[model samples]
Target: MAILPKLGRAIYVLLGGILFTHLGSYMLLPFFAIILSTEKGLSLGSTGLVLGAGSIAFLTGSLLGGFLSDRFGRRLTMVSGLLIRGAGLLGFIWGATFPALFLTNLVAGVGGGIYAPGAKAGIAALASQGTKTTAFSYRGVAANIGVTMGPLIGTYLHTRSSTLLFGGAAVVYFVLAVSHLLLLERDCIGEDCPKVDRQGIRQIFTDRPFLYFSFVTIFVWALFTQFALSLPLRAAQIESARNIGLIFTASAVLVILLQGTVTRFFTKYLHPLGTMAAGIVLIGTGLGSVALSTSFWHLVASAVVITLGQMFVMPTSDAIVADLAKPEQIGSYFGVAAFVFGAGEAIGNIAGGQLMERAVAIDYLPLPWLLYGALGLLLGGAYYLLRLWQPLAKPLAPVMEERTENNPSPFRPKQKT
Candidate 1:
């Protein structure tokens, strides 16, 4: 409600779309392994492979989506992604064989990949500097809400009918595609549009500072991903599966309720880079604290600390990316961010699994948490040092000036240099 006045209609629409997209995705994607193993009678290894392949497909799709959104337009790219995703979800209805399931997973992954960068770019394009962080924070809240609620609904639907679960997700995506088509405007179009510079695109990969930022991002994601990967495993070992669910549920709820307030405080009091560094440190502290947990309450407390760090990290990271990007290259930058996220998640999954397994083998349960926590602390320190050595690029002033000249608005605040 408070966000409505700060962000315009376009931003509101994008936020709504994000909410539904995550809801639809989490609703079905979380249950894929179960569906594959139980219904299709696939081996655990095969299920893991299918899921792993899907992650690759998603990353590939993110790259493609970024390029396409830059070449064409965000609206077109986003709509196309939704349509593809819808088709992929529809495929689940008849996905009896391994190949069918794998193919559908690939399609769905690509679709999500395509949609994400465009949406992020759209938000950056629509929001002014003053409201950008808030916009992204709101986006996080919406996503958290979806994450919190989707699985609960999915469980019920899953118990009743898998068709309804997958089919409903398909319908959600299809409807989103249509909504995007009707409601969203094309970005980076007409005479004022920047030329598609191939060299500039190449520079994105070579931009040392940007790459460094992305490098830090990978660790951030990897550390954060432990919540999904390692935390649950630890929870199971210590307590029960229900405890695992409660841990995540508490996390989602905390994020949804506190993210905005936390983000606002950080934005008001701290510089963006400072916020990020602090967040990383908090994450490390939280993870490290997990090593000491002997009860469910301790884990919950750790999660709360981690969730606070998350509230700071996620939105600030996005806002920083937006600030660093040229107006024309917003989509491409976000795409790169998505790719980095996938890479980080993969590392988290693999390294976390290995660490967990090794710790268990050695009968030292605290080792993995300590190692992850140390890594997080080191990464956070690295990030802060990098910030000192090479301050992030400022928003492109000339482009902002041009936009202001072309379409002057009293609402647009001057960006700090």
Candidate 2:
């Protein structure tokens, strides 16, 4: 009971910061496709090339960021990343040229890449035993909050000036940077923290279980990327841009409302492996259902199913990463996972786009979707097998005498006897 307030405060601060960061990021995401095509007069191929550069840079940056987080500290790495991201956003206001835009994306991608591992690792480090899953679920909820609000706000600003929207995102990043530097304590450092020899990407690969998990999740991430890459275009085919936006907003709202309850329910009743597999199956089925959609209502139902699957998998996956990682190497594990995630999304966007083109060319879009759905279900079955081979790892034994009734401040450094 006594620990509740402190735990809640920590969670609130982290969640609040994440919400603002995601809000700023999403505000610009919707503008990218429209701006590149209409304002810059770029062909679809050229637009893809420009966008793909950022994804590549971001994956590279994730590896570097993970190393830095493990070597230095999470708070410092996060603050530095946010500041770099702010500069990238500011660049968009002055540099409207093609080369400038590409450079802006590269810099911003690196910044985002650096921040992710540190932020996720810090959250895991701070979360109490038995609560890491819940903590990550809250993080997902925070993201949904930002996703819901930021684009709506951007839509209004976008009508006035793209410059204004860009500036707004920059300001938000700057504020988040300052807040992180001032408010986030270095819980990932200090004497109480684990002292392990620094390991690199090589060590990450040696952990076969984690490697396998990352491999499977790449396909999962690819499936999720369809929402950004192909789902909108499909929606646009049937409805106006405004209606498509609303459909997305509704999906975010669904996740925001239901993520916590769903996460709790699944975690309580199901094995993490089973829960994740079920979620993946739902995502694939939801996406495949898109082939059958002839109206807005059908797409809406598909989105709900997809969102529910996401609600199940996201938090559980993060928790699984935390569980697999050694406390000191959490950032590294997350970094590797992020790299795989970025790679999957990048591949998904590029491949999914081409597949869509081919499918549309043949006038049989359902073929590609059916194949994707089968892949997802097959992957889920594979994960079940992997779970049997390598059961989830347990928490590390604490270095200090744990606090309870006798010692209330468990987080404080212990004294010499």
Candidate 3:
């Protein structure tokens, strides 16, 4: 076997790994609440509490995963999380009740959360200089492919049995876990990945650009979470199964096709903040239109419009992070961004359940749609606030290998902001 083709294959493998794992892991997000509340015979209030248990574990695992990625490097982290998630998914396959699922889901969630940084940092290391935007865009393509496929697995396999569906997923996870551990090279962790200097960890939080951009990610992702909850539930009511499928199909294919192009466009005209606001406003518009949806095509149209906005925004956010992060600290920064996403996912799932399933009646307040809309407004408000100061972190190319009376890690001399 030629070395060059093998290397190319390995890079695609890692990118594919990120996508597949995200597919198996999150395919349940939109349906987990509905499954329990409607299928498993639980009250909405009870179901919310159950899902919350798993999310707590997931977020906790995400934080620990980041710190550990700093200390242990990316490969070990990836192997461990894959196996751990596989086992928890097996639990979901076997576990028969709320109590059983609560622990099992959390276990799987933790495993999934822990592995995210390794995937991202791995890709960062793999890219050649000046290709960071395109590289991250490619990673998004893999991830969306995973997202698109995982749901199909759930939709078809679970018709036979939920246990069989999870069992099948477990098999995929186990095989991928082994392939990753055996095949991937060490250098894929990136130069920054293994270096665990926590000296600037505290200050990364205080960095104005990082902080504001992270907030942008939080809301944009929260809006995306509606795909798992609000939008799907609404679609099931208003749209045909084919139309629902079309929405995601459109989103996935569009993202794969347009993310790189959109990132390049942003390279010239729009900043990350602009991209985020534009994407989010489209999501908000999509969500509001979903509220008005009465037919399948209406929902398909909604997915297309919102996803186009996603193409405009998502890769820009990832590119901006790469641009702003100090060369030595890229792993830690990307890890932090991934962790923020996990945290938002937890909140979005639990809160969405409570709002949509009204008869269980937890609070003395109004309905779920009201809450979802207000939350969207909260996202819009944050976007404007982000607009106040930040503008694309101003990309600095990946050069700087030359010694300037110094070892050319030039961003190092600067004190932490």
Order of the predicted models by TM-score, top scorer first: 1, 2, 3
* Candidate 2 TM-score over all chains jointly: 0.87
Measured by TM-score, the strongest candidate is: 1
Compared with the true structure, what per-residue lDDT tens digits does model 1 show for residues 170-277? 999999999988888766465545677989999898877778889888989998999888888888788765767787888888888888778757765565666788
When summed lDDT is taken over every stretch of 10 residues in candidate 2, the lowest stretch is 394-403
Instruction: Give the Cα error of residue 264 in candidate 1, in Å.
Output: 1.3
TM-score for candidate 3, please give it: 0.75
What residue pairs clash in candidate 2, if any at all? none
Structure candidate 1, residue pairs in collision: none
Off by over 4 Å in 1: 1-5, 188-194, 391-417
Each prediction's Cα lDDT score? Answer: 0.84, 0.78, 0.68
Note the clash tally of each candidate. Answer: 0, 0, 1
Model 3 bad stretches (over 4 Å) = 1-10, 26-47, 188-199, 233-243, 288-294, 346-392, 395-417
lDDT of 2 by residue, 135-220 (tens): 88889989989988888888887898888988989899888888888887775556554554645446778887788788889989
